[model samples]
Target: MAELQGFVFPRTATGRSSILPAPPWHYSGDLLTIEYRTDPERVIELLPDPIEPADDPGAVALVWADWQSCSDTFDELLDPVRAQYKEVFFVVRGRYQGEHVSRCVYIWVDKDYALVRGHYQGYPKKLGSIHLTRPVAYGKAGPRLEPGGRFGATLAAYDRRLAEARFTITGTADQGGFVNSHAMLHTRFLPAIEGAQAPPSLHELVTMKTVDVDAGPVYVGDADLTLFDVPGEEFGRLAPREMIGAYYRQVGATFVGGTTVHSYDD
Candidate 1:
């Protein structure tokens, strides 16, 4: 579900101005990976002083999302915007019931609209509109289904609730460190269509890292991510930085990291 998880919400924004400090953690590398989206020129402006690409560093990566290659027909509409702004990102969530999931995304902001392309299970959805909203509801992030089963009703309600909510990128950190973003969205857990029961619990871990550029020792973060399955009521929490580290000393991020990567798996 890595691919799908990454595609969960794109081009949405929350206007709230709140900052949460990055959880204290350590990784082997110093390089940082981010879900970067802004005008290419703006990126250059934010470059650190004495701006020079790392020696023997990796390629200056370009983020691009494709709406045309999806199983879902909505992609065609989203492709046009992607052509304009040129935003792309990838996320790789871990195994879910033994299946690997990955998420890929493309985003662009234009004079008249915000365009976004997302892929999951090869199904793509593109959203376009004149006035873009940040931290848009996850329910509004993609296509919606017509009310059908109990699960369907449940999801519809979740979407309705998320629409009026708010979110903010409180802070961002490196692989070895932690990122803390305060997001409020109506969330629910749906069972698989084939009678599979929902996992006893649900967890979320967002990791951003690079692969080859600043490679070094790896260290996991320490803070836990809290997932409120039912808003206002705590459903569950995932503390991978601690849980994973407890088992493997060197599994997390390390300083002088290599490449940029983001992940969110169920």
Candidate 2:
């Protein structure tokens, strides 16, 4: 008799790895974005040295997305739940190594596979309840992607509402803000289990540029944002002082590789 095992991961498992498969992972999704302005000091507090605030440091973008993702290998899409998930992420404007950049400071996803994949790619992803009002075109009841279309989204953790926003579409554009503006920089830190944990087992500042990028017709809108102060959480500190605008769009990309600008293990 022959033994069975996963090809790349879960060396001890008898079958396919419950974790994510090998990349490049493909993603197709609809997203709602809320762009806002906070304060420079708030943005500064989240960043490390050498990666300073941008010219408009307070500019931030929050996104709520519904995604269907698959790896290079899957069971012919027969299992849909394994490929569906929702995520909300927060991004801020910054300059990395003298170039304008966007850095993801916080992200919350609803699936373990998505979280684990993000960790490997340097995104600080955690689990949360993310609810987005997806537009439906079947009947004339739910929101539609036409003029005056209204949609809302929320993020909650520890049974507390952390963020909220509403958007009403007015027109169309060709692009999105920080979420699609530049190469996203991330801090990949895997702390050591023993000793002061000063030097992590792996500490890196990596950049992400997904291939096969496609931006759908962007719907522009006016937006309102409200952030709540949750106990033991600092998400409220970056509260929006002014609403920039709102947008809804469909975006597609493939994640394969990341470039590390700095490695702190030395």
**Candidate no. 1 TM-score:** 0.19
Which residue pairs collide, candidate 2? none
Q: How many pairs collide in each candidate, listed in order?
A: 39, 0
Each candidate's root-mean-square deviation in Å? 21.4, 2.5
Q: Candidate 1: where are CA atoms >4 Å away?
A: 1-82, 85-100, 103-121, 126-165, 176-266
C-alpha lDDT of candidate 1 relative to the true structure: 0.22
By summed lDDT, the worst window of 10 consecutive residues in model 1 runs over 147-156
Q: Which structure among the candidates has the greatest TM-score? A: 2
The local distance difference test score of model 2 is 0.83
- Candidate 1 differs from the real structure by a C-alpha RMSD in angstroms, to one decimal, of 21.4
- CA shift of 184, model 1, Å: 25
